[model samples]
Target: MDPKETYSPLNCPKPVAEGIWIFDGLMIRMDLGPFKIPFPTRMTVVRLGDGTLWIHSPIAPDEDLFSAVDALGSVRHVIAPNSIHYWYMADWLERYPGARSYAVPDLATTAKRPFRIDHPLMDGARFAWESEIDWILVPGTKVSEAVFHVPSARTVILVDLIENFEAAKLSSPLMRFMLKLVGGLDPNGMAPLDLRMTFRPKRKQVRERLQRVVDWQPEKVIMAHGRIYDRDGAQELRRAFRWAI
Candidate 1:
């Protein structure tokens, strides 16, 4: 269905469902120490019943983007689903003065932060988002990605539990090769090899979480990086996690 079209013109919010939107941001490179890999940045924005907005994994917000989001609703809650995705909370925190910040329990312990987490709980809900979104935390990974489902939209929001990098979009041969080597390519993308191995020890836990997502039966799966799944989401969930669960 040409999923890349869903994330075009990067840096703008594209509607994914009724109250949900996915913002495609810039291409950022991450250093793996041995080498750097290019990652397409993305984030999700959901408007609450109170007309306030909840931003999942904040990207670098520009003035135009800020104005567009303001038109949608006020940014009241900013969340970092995992340690790797928490880097930009400082920006959203400063932009939305009273917005509460959320993240994994171990985030502030290691990942350097210029900000503080008002809620360090990713499993429980102390806010209104719970009524709309259901989430399961994937254990045994460095990222500790929290996968969420928006029942109203029949959609699942994922940060990095599965990555489907398109070969055509990847410019570097080495990067393409690395992704292919780690089974990060499209049509078969799931957790990378390293994450699969980490999850091996906790396959039962990962299986339980994966089963919950499949049970949601989403119409689409939105990821922070790589092409998204817009159909057969339940079947895709099983295929994607076959390595772990």
Candidate 2:
């Protein structure tokens, strides 16, 4: 067994949009039911103008996953947005020997693998090259923090903090209903129906983060699960945690 191989089935479906291709499934979530997600996974590939490439949220391990990445040209960096999203990084690092992997602030200590997390993202951190991608650390609710927004593409990528399962291709009725019950249909698709209420005391802080997101005026919003939000993303997010925002 490859010590770095944390994934079971390996590989996931391939979905491409704009200049990014999403690779889904990299872990096994037995709790998700007969969903056969192989692993609930999603990955993003961005090709910048200078010919450098960036892939975010590497999911599960599979022979095919690496081959798929190899097909996309040389990958320069792999970003593990949060601790929960680091499961497959070891395998990805092993596969792309020369590629650099970066971990969000709180994830590196527990990652258990050796790699330099070249970038550390704090709340409201903005990175700009020819295009601009902002990382807003939404703290307090969960121990996790997400790197949000890619201005050049008008896209927002949230890890566990916000999920949109619409990309999961759920054929099971139970899965769909479960998703709806948890507000998965919403733009942010926050976990626990009561997440807003869980952090009721910090509602003010949450609202401040939301306000910053609203200021960005993103055109496209993508979560780990559910459908992508194309229009009125700010309002959708506000409505998701109505109590908090």
Query: Which regions of candidate 1 deviate over 4 angstroms?
Result: 1-7, 122-125
Give one digit per residue, the lDDT tens place, for model 2 in 131-178: 545666665544555656767777767665565555235555676677
Candidates' lDDT values, in order?
Answer: 0.81, 0.61
Report the C-alpha lDDT of model 1 over 1-245, residue by residue, as the tens digit.
Answer: 23342356867768878988888887777774487777888999999888989899888888887887888899988988866888888888998889998887778786786577898756655665788778778777555767888888888988778888888887778878888888778878887787677767778888888888888999899888788888888889888877765
lDDT score, candidate 2:
0.61
Model 2: CA > 4 A from native: 1-17, 30-39, 112-116, 123-131, 166-181, 185-188, 194-202, 230-232, 241-243
Model 1, C-alpha of 120: deviation from truth (Å): 1.7
How much is 228 displaced in model 1, in angstroms? 0.9
For candidate 2, the per-residue lDDT at 243 reads 45
Backbone clash count for every predicted candidate, in the order shown? 0, 11
In terms of lDDT, the best-performing candidate is: 1
